[model samples]
Target: MASNMGIQIGNAWFQRKINLRPQHRGVHLVTEEILRQVPELLQFSVGLCHIQILHTSASLALNESWDPDVRDDMEMMLNKIIPEDMPYRHSCEGPDDMPAHVKACFLGSSLSIPITDGKLALGTWQGVWLCEHRNNAGSRRRGFILIAKMASPRNQSRRPFTVCIEGNIGSGKTTFLNNFKQFNNTMVLQEPVELWRNVEGMNLLDLMYKDPGRYACLFQSYVQLTMLQLHTMKSPLPYKIMERSVYSARCFIENMKRTNVLKEVEATVLEKWYDWCINHALIETDLIVYLRTTPDIVYKRMRARARQEENLVSLEYLEQVHQIHEDWLYHRTLFDVPAPVIILDADQSMEEMFVQFEKCKTRIFERCRQSERESRLLTSPVSSPKIGAASE
Candidate 1:
């Protein structure tokens, strides 16, 4: 038999394979004892765990609820997609056979799961299952591969070298923006919704947790007003930062489209508004940063802020908003925008996240300068000296 190839690099790699025979039914042991069997597989903090089934008709999984019914449901679904006895040119093996390989290949032969707390981060109902689709369930010598990396402490004080944050209400945008303002040689620009805080008949509070269908016009109108006031006609301050941009209004509308909240007529109006901003708005971004947080966190932080409008927000409603934000950003990535995008996971603390922002800024500025130098070389009549002395 051929040996399985593997390699470990640094203090953060782990792998082990377990052999299984055909007809070996029932849950196989996945305890620390199995890990102890491989002496070289230890010594990593936290990383990805990847497993591959060697046989074409075999597979692996973390069974949910340990229920046979779930397995039956999965098998039924796969068979529907690729029937066993349908076509048979490849029947060189057997009638119910080669297609079994086809089926397994289609279904997938590997899985990668995150490892945390020194164990796989599977839910209570989940378990690892090695599936065998071949009739010959003899000792088939199936294998398991475990990979890991060492976990290091989170960076708590990383500054925002370049940062731009945007999100819906109670989404922790301001909280993150303030932290960025405090670090680096920073100047902060805040969103201008404060002006609409006193608009009469505006039930901004109701819009916080309810469907945005009825309030889209009002919200966008208010957004336009705020942008008009916030965007200075003059050039932005050097090294200064903005919380939201003129383009963010388009992002909000894209989010509304994902939730079925914006009607056809509303979408038309929003497109016009977006075109106007693109053609006429003074706003420009060095890097666009998006904050993604769970709705549960949004509501929790909303209540923490003690705002009357945000007090009544519910977990379920905020979940919808979270989904909207996720979908919107995903669709936005399909387009080629003028600026680079940096997506920040909002679950981290202020200090930890700032470090990430700073790293992004450093990378972005380096790229920007490189692009400028290349452009000068391409367009200039003569070459200038390189910015630095020759390397040793």
Candidate 2:
């Protein structure tokens, strides 16, 4: 069963795949075709739009839009640089097949352009060109990913202030979320660990721990998909809190890369997807609450909880995970920090942890109120002073 997979944010993010009508092999201007297919581009004021061709025989480039001679010269130059008359071994598809692939590689397969004032910020003389290398190439498919930033009206309901709780395995994250359950107007999203435990009655978590070399890539891929689902979910409350986020998922994948569980190609593909999601998706994080704890403390807690899949987990592994989290969230030297962080000592006992949660609650609510005030100020209309009446 074929299924559609991708992310979209109300007017902020847009993604689509469209097939261009067949054209004779040449460098043809395609800016109009693209704009016609993706009218959503008009909704963005300030953003980036990325277009990637799905085929290797064709490519995309930004060049002269006004004169036809410029495009003709470009195609003439490409053919000269890589001629079809040359004898090539990989000619099963035709004489132009190998040269087409090479031309596509030389010119590249993707182009990213900035968007301003709900339109492509192309220079007056620049336009998108579709370089067709083959003689009778059919319709070509291109994927578009667009992201924008828009201000909300003062009376409009804004997206909830989101918080992501990050910690090592069994770092009292579940306990912390439970404490927030009593508060009204707040939505708490826990990690989908249960789904990991039984994916169609197969324990992927157990397989990963038992044989990481074989299952790490598979496990992490599914994890990323699930985390994306969580990140894009809508909340009806004023505040949204999640146990772990897509950013934290990257930390685990990085750990797998460092441990040699994931190969370089596998890691690269995952990292690229992660980068795209972070940059283009609508996964917003206003604050990150890091439950900082020692490996020994968490290991003890994990053992006490006695989860079946975690029986093989060791303190050594937990230490590595701890350091990765520290490098990412605390040191701020690894990937980008999506939001402000609030570090808490999670080594306390249950009673003490509750007290800590109480203190953190106050800060969280205060930030929420402050954000509301700022949003009002930004969305409220500015009034001009009366010319004759007020002179303070």
Q: Which prediction has the highest TM-score against the true structure? A: 2
Question: Candidate 1 regions off by >4 Å?
Answer: 1-163, 180-186, 199-214, 228-233, 255-263, 328-336, 357-392
The window of 10 residues in a row where model 2 has the poorest summed lDDT is 147-156
lDDT of 2 at 365: 90
Candidate 1: residue 81 Cα off by (Å): 88
lDDT by residue (223-267, candidate 1, tens digit) is 765564344322112344567766666666665676677888888
> Distance from true position, residue 366, model 1, in Å?
4.7
Worst 10 residues of 1 by lDDT: 153-162
Clashing pairs in 2: none
Candidate 2 Cα outliers beyond 4 Å, as residue runs:
1-156, 387-392
Residue lDDT tens for model 2, 1-392: 01133434443555655545556888999887666444445445567788888788988899999999999999999999999988899999999999999999999988988876556889999999989999977544333333333321111146888999999998999899988877756767778675565454467889999999888888888888777867776554678888899999998998888888899999998898888888888899899999999999999999998988898998989999999999998998988898999999999998998889999999999999999999899989998888888667
